[model samples]
Target chain A: MLGRLNHVAIAVRDAEKAAKIYGAAFGAEISAPLPLPEHGVITVFAILPNTKIEFIQPLGETSPIAKFVERNADGGIHHVCYEVPDIVATRDILIAEGARVLGDGEPKIGAHGKPVLFFHPKDFSGALVEIEQS
Target chain B: MLGRLNHVAIAVRDAEKAAKIYGAAFGAEISAPLPLPEHGVITVFAILPNTKIEFIQPLGETSPIAKFVERNADGGIHHVCYEVPDIVATRDILIAEGARVLGDGEPKIGAHGKPVLFFHPKDFSGALVEIEQS
Candidate 1:
């Protein structure tokens, strides 16, 4: 079952620059950008009380978010990650409900080092959703 | 100062149908659709532990989100709302930081019956941000 609303990821051209307002105006603590070459993204986190806002930029030419940033230009909400007690079980349930899991239907080690799976946007009414093992 | 992330609003064609996956697959509590003609939207809430996911549909032809739904046929993440201790102060600070506040730059009574203000997406790296009084 779904647990906490983990974090919302925003695709941007510059992760750190995109998070500056959260630190300067909202007074939220922002983490320094960290590159994950395997994931092809550089991420910056704006730590909030109950959740976090993740700003992600492309780490390489083949980055998964590269097309998203190109399409959005100014950047946009890329996906929402939710915590699940059992990701594999959750994926099976979602598949049974006619949801399409992205990427060969296997949970991958996500940005938070948890097993995670992403669902296709079309099946979820145009919102890409990620389920992370809690 | 910014507090919790209140909710993420997703613009969809049908609020009830859009929230079905959360209830059926994620086992999340989904609220009955509530029409706010004044705001020109019919909203259904998928209650998560840390925050809520709001599914909104246009109420009438002149609804504000009509254009968004038109642009994104499958629906999409519309805005992210964050809670603030003092909305007025927060708005002033955001403005002083060169962020463009949407509309008249004044806090309006939001769907939750609390003062809220929206920032232009361009100013927030292409993501519409809402700040509500906590």
Candidate 2:
């Protein structure tokens, strides 16, 4: 159903600053910072040895990520993404089993050029999880 | 530094039920249910094809995870755990860089016999992250 964890999404106030802080702490350098216009967030990818930690911040106040950070009081884990071989199949199965899809249609290209879709937090406890395929 | 993502921890009100729901939705089976007394939580491991999702529920109301669930108003992604080769070195480095350690002192044996320690969410945004060495 799922593949390896593509990346763990971390919400931050500033992507560049957070990347620098984390890079200094973990002894790793940031890969590249990309702006996700559709999601209304800018993200910096910090590729660790085995896992990639993404630092995300809203581009503007109207961004959904910004709204999420505001609601949570501080930035937190926005979503956990797992790589899946087939996004449509997995999404269909989950929806059939009563899991709600946050996205309206099929999976779309997400950060890192992978197809991704989100499952509502209500369906899987309170964690907003994303399923992606590389 | 890190090996791979051992698992992603999800806090739930009912581990067993959550396991069943996820199992049905993902077409995966519950590997085994384990009781972690020190964390004051019981967990059931749901191994998916490429990733393992852990369902954790507090044994009692006083449990830290229970308190987290309550504070969040619903169960959410509690912590993200990455498998590391050296928990001690990682803990020391993070602490030296002004990261707070939620667990006192050294890493201890966790649910799966791996030594684990938690870094305070304040240091890494708002997500409680656990590092484990198996």
Candidate 3:
């Protein structure tokens, strides 16, 4: 079963500005900004009482986030992540259902320091989804 | 503080198809399709272990969801809802921080039967956010 809504991620040209908006408006406690070169993104987590909002900004010219921001211009919600009790099982089941898992078809250590898998947006209609081990 | 990630909503042309996909892939329990005429949408909640994934379909020609689907063609993630301890207080605080709360600037009974408020997408950097009283 899906454990919980892990985090909702937004792709922005400037995540600091987005984080500031959440901080100033909702008084959200935001994390120190983190840069993941391998992921080609800079990330920050706006911690809420029960969940998190992730602000993602492109760290390189060819980052997928950069392309998203380019298409949306004003930026937009990038993806939503869900926590799963067993990500590997989740992956196997999703694969059996004819869904395409992105990347190398294996779990990778994500920003949360947990095994995570990404599903193709097409598989979920349009929303990109991430499943993380809880 | 925002209480929890209430639900991640997706606007779809066919919520049933989406629900079926989730049901098949994750074996999730889905609510009966609910039509909210006032909101001009049909909604179904895929119950997970800790959070909900809401699938929304336009019920009218002029629905904002219809327009979103038109623009996106394939539909996409629409908005995210967060639970708050007090909806009115959250509204006031957001206003004080110069964020525009949509509609009448007052809380209304939402689909969850809780007081809720919608924030302008621009204010939150293109993410439409809903704050619902927990």
- Tens-place lDDT per residue, model 3, A17-131, is 8899677766789888899988889998899766788999999877868778988777799888988888999999899988899999889998768999999887887989899
Model 2 over residues A71-111: C-alpha lDDT tens digits? 76657888878777888888888888888898585888876
At residue A50, what lDDT does model 3 achieve?
67
Q: Provide per-model DockQ scores.
A: 0.89, 0.55, 0.67
True contacts kept of each: 0.86, 0.55, 0.69
Candidates in descending TM-score order: 1, 3, 2
User: Which residue pairs show backbone clashes in model 1?
Assistant: none
Model 3 Cα lDDT, one tens digit per residue, B22-128:
88877789888999888789999898766788999999777768888887666798888988887888889888888888888878888778888899888887889
Q: Regarding lDDT, does 2 or 3 come out ahead?
A: 3
For model 1 chain A, where is the 10-residue window of minimal lDDT? A1-10
Clashes of 2: 1
lDDT (C-alpha) at residue A102 in model 2? 82
Candidate 1 C-alpha lDDT tens digits along B24-78: 9999999999999989999999999889999999999899899999998999999
Per-candidate alpha-carbon RMSD to the true structure: 0.7, 2.3, 1.8
Model number with the top DockQ: 1
Deviating ranges (above 4 Å) for candidate 2 = B48-51
